[model samples]
Target: MENRWFAYLIPPFIVTLLLVAGSQFVFIQNSFYQDLGLGRTGTDLTLVNYIKFFTDSFYLKTFWITIKVSAIAALLTLFLGFPIAYVVARMKSRLAMFLLAGIVVSTFVTIVIKVFGLIIIFSADGVINKTLLNLGLIERAYSIIGTQEGVVIGLMHFTIGFSVLLLYSVVVTVPPSLEYAAQIHGASRLRVYQRVIIPLCAPGFVVGGLMIFNMCMGAFTSAALLGGGRVLTLPVLVQRTVMMEVKYSTAASIAFVLLVSVILINLFSLIAIRRLRSARLVVA
Candidate 1:
């Protein structure tokens, strides 16, 4: 019976592989051809699109901006989420479940609704600006729309809940007795967290940070709505290249570049982390 049940998984697994990896393979393969405008491609394979992306200042700037915003948002999300996750994970009452459920529900809410909510709050006549204006905080209203800051904020909002959930799981895995022992040994609360909790959670932190970074890199709705067309990330550029410019080959090349960059960064990060761990072990 167990063998029969295991057999049932193979078909869906194959289908998923075909739909996901197969499509990506086909898309990336198109990048080798030259774009001839209007969704057309040259018959001969060439590296012109990739070369143009590398040579053009605009494309390079957009690529860097995407990495910048994603990195900033991922780091910020981890910082903001850690405290909330710690508090919830350490809770003794049923309220912890309620809080986790709330976070889960809010995280799953549609991105369109969330983006519009941000726009309303940040608009010139909106609550934040009005309150700041009334308090004489500034001479004029400040807007995040069409700004890199806005994109970062949007990305943070999108990933914060996930970060909290990820960190919560990590935090819970750490035995409470270790924290108690640290405190009993004359360690301060901050010291307990710094010395006992953080080091143990380092692996989880790297994995969670990478996951959040990857999400921010591929995010489109939040970037599009918050950026207000002023900031262009690689995903946004890919969309414009395919839709507005009608250059499928160019868009494919851009997509391929984004994919490769993400993979390379992740690989380097994991390598650096492993080296650091090895050095720490040697020192100990």
Candidate 2:
């Protein structure tokens, strides 16, 4: 307790210093050079690599795609996670533990396995295809693979479990009596959720949202395997840049920009949470 103020920020300050130094070292050493078609190191320093990224439509398109995918994934996780969290938090018993365990296990299931499962269920000549054919719902097999829909669905499956768990933990911490009081005041079940539980769980949702958003932004493996390279996200583009051109500098630049964007998103979420806390305190 003697150095309480020191205890408040010294850890994060140390971490920030180390992170900034390391990132700067990497960026400076790698970024000032040119990628001579195969990254053989050109004779002179040129800003052309960075310039190309901004000017080229292909990279610009990839940036837009990346943002779109991340936004959809974050929102999907929020909606899918909120109700599951509400139920798990309100329902007290060993069943809650069992459900929590299921979510934990589901969260770690490899994307490849998930995509394979979806293929079995959603592929051409798969269950839906066959069922629809037999029932005359559709005249032909619907191709769902290697599509944006596939990528979005896969990302939702990949992210929702952790979101549910994080929000569940926060929801369970909310005092039960508050909800009971609202109910006594004639608030409907849904109204209680909207007015009371959501605000209480806002901080946890922000944490989970940032996590999902950042992961979705850099999501390479899932989008690659599931979307089958049809989806051109920023991470996929970065990988292709490195592989096709062997251009570390260009790749590093894109990656640095991506990391900076993710940091800003997290920072914004933290500020939003603080604002929400201030509003809640004002109401109390």
Best by TM-score: 1
Which 10-residue span in candidate 2 carries the lowest summed lDDT?
275-284
Q: What would the per-residue lDDT of candidate 2 be over residues 87-200, giving only the tens digit for each residue?
A: 888886889999999999978888778767877788887988999999999998987668887777777777888789888887888999999998999999889877887767
For candidate 2, the per-residue lDDT at 199 reads 68
lDDT of each: 0.94, 0.80
Q: Give the TM-score of candidate 1.
A: 0.95
Instruction: Please count the clashing residue pairs in each candidate, in the order shown.
Output: 0, 0
Q: Best candidate, lDDT-wise?
A: 1
- Candidate 2 has an lDDT of 0.80
lDDT for residue 242 in candidate 2, whole number 0-100: 85
Candidate 1 Cα outliers beyond 4 Å, as residue runs: 1-14, 281-284
Worst lDDT 10-window in candidate 1: 275-284
lDDT of 1 by residue, 139-251 (tens): 89999999999999999999999999999999999999999999999999999988999998888889999999999999999999999889999998899888899998899
Assess candidate 2 and give its TM-score to the true structure: 0.83
